[model samples]
Target: MRVLHGLEEIFAAKGSLLGTSDWVTVDQARIDAFAGATGDHQWIHVDPERAAAGPFGATIAHGYLTLSLLPMFMVAVYRVEGARMAVNYGLNKVRFVTPVRVGSRLRGSTELVDAQPLDGATAQLVFRTTVEIEGAERPACVAETVSRQYFGD
Candidate 1:
C-alpha cells in the first residue's frame, strides 16, 4: 500500500504508479447481488445457464459492476492522510475494454496521473486505473477518476 503523508506528498507522487490491489473474484453470487441491487437482470450477467450457450461460455459481469469496484481498488492501492475529508468528484474517460466473465479474478492497478491545488484547503486529484483480469491479455476496464481532498487549516 502507498501512503501519502500530506497533500504535498500526494502532489509529489503524481505521474507514478500508486499500487495494485489484491485480486477479487467475480462470482455468480456477487453478480446476482449486483443484478438485484441495480435491477439489471440481463441474461449475460445473471443467467448462467442461458449465458453458457449465448456467448463467452459463461455469464459475464455488467460493465458498470466492474466499474463500481473502483473505491475498493483505491482503498487497497493507497491513502492520503491528514485530509479532513475526501469525496469522489466524478469519472472522466472510462472504457470497458474487455468483458469480465464470472469466476474471473480481477484487480486494479492505479497511477497518480495528476494532482492540483484547488485552494488553500482543497486539492483535486486524478488517477488513471486499469482493472486487469487474471491471466488475460487485455484489461477489463480503464478509467480516469477524479477526487477532491479537503484539508484543515
Candidate 2:
C-alpha cells in the first residue's frame, strides 16, 4: 500500500500511480445482496441458470455494484496519516468497460490525478481508478473519483 504522511504528500504525488489493491472476488452471494439492496434484480446479474444461455456465459455483476467497491478498493491503495477524516465528494466520470462475471477476482489500480488544497485543514483529491477483472484484457470499470480529506488540527 502507498502511505502518504500528510495531505501535502498526496498533493505532491499527483500524476503518479498510487497503489494497486488486493483482489476481491465478485461472487453470487455478494451480487445477490447488492441486488437486494439496490433493487436491481436483472437476470444477468442474479439468475445464474438463465444467464448461462444469455450473455457473458454466466451471471455477471451490475456495473454499479462494481462501482460501489471503490471505497473498499481505495482503502487498500493508500492512506494519509494526518488526514483523520475523509468523505467521498463525487465521481467525475465512470464507465463499465466490461462485465464482471460471477466468481471473478477484481482489484483496483489507482493513480493520483489531482490534489487541490481546500482550506487550512482540508484538501480535495482526485483519483483515476480502474477496476480490473482477473485475466481480462479490459477493466470491469474505470472511474474518476473526488474526495475531501480533513486533517487534524
Candidate 3:
C-alpha cells in the first residue's frame, strides 16, 4: 500500500497509479447478502439455479455491488496519513463494462486523477478506479470516485 504523507504528497501524486488491491472473490453468499441488504434480488444476481439458464450461465454480482467495493479496494490501495478524516464525496462516471460472476476473483486498480485543495485544510481528490475480474479481458467496472480529506491530523 502507498501512504501519502500529507496533502502535498497527495496532490503531487496526481495522474499516477496509487496502488492495486488484493483479489476478492465474488461468491453466492456475498451476492445473496447484498441482495438482502439492498432488496435487489434479481435472478441474475441472487438465484444461481435460475441464472444458470440465463445470460452468463451463472449468478453474477450486481453492478452497484461491484461499485460498492471501491472503499474496500481503496483500503488496500493507499492512504493519506496526515488526513484527519476522509469522506466519499461522490462518483462522477461509472460503467459496468463486464459482469462479475460468482466465484470470480476481483481487484481494483486506483489512480490519482486530480486533487484540489479546499478550505478548512481539506483536499478533494479524484480517483479513476477500475475493478478487474480475474482472467477477464474487460474490467467489471470503471468509475470516477471523489473523496474529501481533511489534512493535518
Candidate 4:
C-alpha cells in the first residue's frame, strides 16, 4: 500500500499503479445479499439454476455491485494521512466489460489519474480503477472514480 503524505504529493505524480487489493470472492451468499439489499434479483445474478441455462452459464455479480466494491478495494491499496475525512465525490465513467461469476475472485488495480484542488483544504482526486476477475481476459469493471479529501485547517 502507498502511504500518501498529502494531497499535493498525490497530485504531483503523473500516474501510479497504487497497488492491488486482496482477492474477494464473489459468492452466492454475497450475490444474494446484494440482490436483497438492492432489490436487483435478476436471474443472471441471483438464480443460479436458471442462469446455468442462460447467458454466461452461471450467476454473475451485478455491475453495480462490482462498482460498489471500489471503496473496499481501494482502501486495501492505499491510505491518505493528515486528512480529516475522505468522501466519494462521484464517478466520471464506468464500464463493466465482463461478468463476474459467483465464486470468482476479484481484485482492483488503481492508478492516480489526476487531482485538483477545491475550495477549503479539500482536493478532488480522479482514479482509474480496474476490477480484474481471476482467469478472465476482460476486467469485471473499469471506472474513473472521483473523491474529495479534506485535510486539517
Higher-ranked by lDDT: 1 or 2: 1
Over the full model, what C-alpha lDDT does candidate 4 score relative to the true structure? 0.90
CA lDDT for candidate 1: 0.95
Candidate 3 Cα lDDT to native? 0.93
Clash count per candidate: 0, 0, 0, 0
CA RMSD per model (angstroms): 0.7, 1.0, 1.0, 1.1
lDDT by residue for model 4 (88-138), tens: 888899999998988999999999898888976889899999999989899
Better of 1 and 4 by TM-score: 1
Model 1 C-alpha RMSD to native: 0.7
What would the TM-scores of all predictions be? 0.98, 0.96, 0.97, 0.96
Clashes of 4: 0
| lDDT (C-alpha) at residue 118 in model 2 | 82
Give the CA lDDT, 0 to 100, for residue 51 in model 4.
98
**How high is the lDDT of residue 116 in model 4?**
86
Candidate number with the higher lDDT (1 or 4): 1
Question: What ranges in model 3 sit over 4 Å off?
Answer: none
**Model 1 lDDT tens row, 1-153:** 999988889899999999999999999999999999999999999888899999698999999999999899989989899998899999999999999999999999999999999998899999999999999999999999999999996
Model 3 over residues 45-71: C-alpha lDDT tens digits? 987889999989999999999999999
Whole-model Cα lDDT of every candidate shown, in order: 0.95, 0.93, 0.93, 0.90
Error of 2 at 1 (Å): 1.3
Alpha-carbon shift of residue 35 in model 2 (angstroms):
0.5
What CA RMSD would candidate 4 show?
Answer: 1.1
